[model samples]
Target chain A: MSEPESDSISKGKDGLTIHTVSKDRLLEFMKDMKERGFNHLSLITGVDRRDYVEVVYHLHAMDRDEYVVVKTTTDNGVVPSMTSLWNSARWDEREQYDLMGIKFEGHENLKRIFLPENWVGHPLRKDYDLSNVQYINMDEDGEDYATFDQGDGW
Target chain B: MNNFVELNFGPQHPSTHGVLRLRAKLDGEIVRELEPIIGYLHRNAEKLCELTFYADNLIFFDRMDYVASMLMESGYLEAAEKILNIPPPERVLWIRVIMNELSRIASHLVWAGAFGLDLGMLTPFFYCFAQRDYILDVFTEVCGSRQETNYMSVGGVYQDLTPEMIEHIDAFLQSFPKKLEEIYRLFVKNDIFISRNKGIGVLSKETAIDYGVTGPMLRASGVNYDVRKANPYLVYDKVDFDVPISQKGDNLARFLVRFEEMRQSVRIIKQAITKIPDGPFFNPKAKKSMMIRLRGDGEYYARTESPKGEFGVYIVGDGGVKPYRVRVRSPSFKNLSVLPVLAKDQMISDLISISGTIDLVFGEVDR
Candidate 1:
C-alpha cells in the first residue's frame, strides 16, 4: 500500500477533532497547530492498546473556541516530549511514563510521578499483574515492614 | 559567598494544606528553586475506574475532589452520558445547574475561610465557615449527605428536589449575601491582607496559559476562558453570569476572582430556580440497577467548570459494562505543576500564601 497521509485529522466519536500525526513529524505538527491558535495544552495521557501504546494530547484554542486531540501510536512505547513547546506537558509526560510506561524522549524530568521510585512495574499496562500486591508499612523501619504477596490483603 | 539551603515545606505542614510536600532550595529567606512532591494521597482512582461499571464509578469521582464533589461527579456523569448517548430531562438539567452552582459557592466558601486562616486572620475563617455550613446544610437536606454527595447518576440525578429543599435553598440565597458582605468587610478590604497578597507570587497571563492553569487562577491572569462560558453544558447556556477576570495575576487577583465568582454562581442559581420547568427529573427509560452499556469502541471527553478549575473526564468504552480506560484530567494536578515556577525568587514565607491561593485539594492532585 502507498504511504498514508502523514497528518490526518478526523472527528472523534465525541465532539473533539482528532488529528493523527506521524511520530517523526509530531513536533512539527504540534508547533504548526500551536501557531495556528491551539495554545492551551489541556491534557496529555496515554492508552495501552495491548498491541501498541497511543499517546494523546488534548489542546484547546481559547480565542476560536476549538478543541483538538493530537495522538500518535508507538510500538516501542516511546514518543517525543512536548515540554519544549508547552511547559504544561512536563508533569503529564511524567505521569504517562509512570502509569502506561510510554517514555517521552527529551523530557526534562522523566520519572515515576505517582508511584515510588522503586516501583517494579507500570500499573496501567495490560500485561501487568494486578493480583501481585505489595504493602508498605510506614511505621516500621526496614525491609521486614514491606511485604509482597500474591492474591492476599494485609 | 553564596549559600543555598534546602528546605522541606510540607506533606505535614498545616499551611501546605492536604499533604503537599514542597522541597525548596532557599538562599537565606528567599527561595531559589522549589519542587512539589505529590502522590501521598494517590488512590489509583483512574486505575480503579477501569474495573467498575459506568454508574458505579460516580462515587469514586466524589473522592477525587472532596472539596467540590458535585462538580467532579457532574464531569464524569456528563462524559458517561455522552458515550451512552443519553440526555436527561429538562428538569434534571435545571436541577443540576442549581446543585452545581450551589456546590461552587460551598467550595469557595471553604477556600475563603482556609485562605483567611493561611493569611493569619482567624476571624474571617470562622465567618466564612459559618456561611459554608449553611450551604452544606442545604446539601445534606437535598442529597442526604453534605461533602461527598454521590448524587449525580449517568442519565440524571439520583433524587429530585423537594419543596422543603427549595425553601431551604431560597433561605440560603437570601442570607448568604449578608454573610458574604461581612466576609468582604472582614478580609477583602483589610489592608494587612492586601499587603501580604497584592503582588506576591505573580503568574503572568502568558505563563498561566503556557502552564495550562484554569479557573480563577487563569482568570486572575486576565484570561477570559471558563468552561461554563467557553463551552456551555447543561443549563449553563441559558443562565446569565459574568466570567470575572483580573490583570494582576497575583494572590490578591486570585482571591478577588473567586469572590466575584461566588456572586456570579449565586446569580446563576437564582436564574435556574425561576426557569426550572415542572417535569420529570430523570429519563424514564434510565433504569436504576441496569448496567449502562456505552457505544462500542468509542472515546469521549467531557469537562465542567469545577470550583477549582476545569475538571475533565475521558472514558473509552469497548462494548462492555466496564470502561476500557478512564482518565481524570484534574485541574489541581495541572495547577499545582506551576508552583515551582511561581515560587521561584520569592521569600520562603510567601510560599504558604502562594500555595494557599492556588487552592489545592490533594485528593484531586494525587488522583
Candidate 2:
C-alpha cells in the first residue's frame, strides 16, 4: 500500500519527513522506496515510548537528495522486527534490546550487543538505576566502585 | 549441506581487529557465512557527549578514532563552531590542517604496521612505530598531550603552535616522504604480501556507498567521494590535493589507497605550510567567561575525512553550556556494516586480510 506521491508525510528535524506505515506493509514499502530510488539506509536507531518502543529508520535517497524517516512502534511486549527488509537493522535492533529492553521478533540471532549477557536491567531506560550499580575505573587507581546502600533505605 | 564447521573467531582473539567477535561457518577453507559480533568496547560515546560541555566534548571525540584523534577532534570543533556562528582565525585553521594531516600520516603508519604484523611480518610494526613516535612527540610539544588531546577548542586551538614545533613538523615532513617510499617498496612488492592481498574480499561501489562506507574503503571501490572534496570543511578548499582512487576494491586496493592518501596529506601540508597566514588563533568573541555561553540552538552535522573514513558529528544544542544531544556518525561503524555481506563465501584465511584492509579501530566502531 504505497502512500500517494503528493501526500507529504510527517516532517521532523532537518526537514526530514516521518512516514507511518503498517508493519504488514513494511517490506512492500521498502521495496517500493527502492524502486523510487531511496537506496541508502543511513541510520537505524530506537527511541523509548512509555507505553511502547519505537524503531526509527533513516533512509537517504541518492537520486532525490532527500531524507525520509520511517518509524515502527511495537506494543509493550510484542517485538516487531524489520530485519528481513534491511539486514543492517539486525544489529541496531539487538542494541535496542540490550539498552532499551525492546526485543526484536524474528531477529535471526538477537542477543545482547552493547552490554554483557549477565548484566541486570537495561541501563538506558529512564527508570534505570544510576546508583548502587558497579562501575569500573578506566583511568588510574584500578578501583571498582559501587554506590549500594549499606543501611536501610535512606 | 552440513559440511561447514562453525568457528568463533574472536571476542578476544588478536587478529579479529579490536574486541570484535565473529562467528563464521566454513566449508573446508571457504567461509559459508559470517556473522559479525560487535559492541565489546562500547562506552556509550553518544551519551557521554550529551553530558559534557560543547567545548569539552573534544576530549571524548579523540578516543573515538584513536588512530586519527586530531581529525575526530577537529571534526567536533568545526561543528561546534558552525553552530555557535564563530569563525576561528586563519592561524587556527592552518594549525588544524597541519595537525589533521600529521594525524593522517600517523594513522596510516600504524595501519601499515598492524597489517604487516597481521600478515606475519614483524619489522614493519617496529619501523612504523619508530616514525609514529616522532609524530606523537610533536603532538606532545604543541598540545601537551599525546594520544588523548582535547586540544582543539570550539572557536580555536588549545594554544599556539610554537615556531620550534613548526620547525620539527617541517623537518619531519621533508623526511617522511622518503620513509613512505621505503616502507612501500619493502612491503608492497613482497611476494607473500601480494599473494595474501591480491584478490581477497572484493567490495563493489554500490555496496560501499549503500553501507555508507567512506574514506579509503570507498575510494578503493573507485568511488571518488572524499568528505574533504565533496563536503569541504576547515580550509580544505583553499589547499589542493588529488583524492587517489582504485577500482579493485580488494584488500590490496584498500591498502594502496591509504598509501596514496598519506602522500596526498604530505602534499597538502607542504602547500599549507607555505601559505599559512599569520593571525590570532582563537576567536575573541567566543565566550571566555567562567560560565561559557551557548547562545543559539540548532542541529549541525560536520563531517571530516578522518584517516579511517568520514567521521561525522551531529550536535543538538539548547542554548546552554552543554549539548542537549550529541550523536557521532562514526565511519568505522558504517564501514563494518558491510563485513557480513563481504565476508560471505570468502576463505577463513582471507578474513584477517579483509578486516585489516578495512582498518577499523574498535574504539570508533563499538563506541
For candidate 1, write residues B300-336 as lDDT tens digits: 9888999888899988888887889998898988999
Instruction: Name the candidate that leads on lDDT.
Output: 1
Query: What TM-score does chain A of model 1 get?
Result: 0.86
Model 2 residue B195 lDDT? 94
Q: Can you tell me the CAPRI class of model 2?
A: acceptable
- The ten-residue window of minimal lDDT in model 2 chain B covers B287-296
Give residue B166's lDDT in candidate 1 (0 to 100): 85
Estimate, for each residue in B62-148, the C-alpha lDDT of model 2 and write its tens digit: 888887898888988767887777789889998999999999999999999999988998888888888888899999998888887
Per-model lDDT: 0.86, 0.77
Question: Which candidate's TM-score is highest?
Answer: 1
Which clashing pairs does model 2 show?
A10-A18
lDDT of 1: 0.86
List-wise, what DockQ does each model earn?
A: 0.76, 0.30
Error of 2 at B166 (Å): 2.4
Summing lDDT over every window of 10 consecutive residues in candidate 1 chain B, give the lowest-scoring window.
B288-297
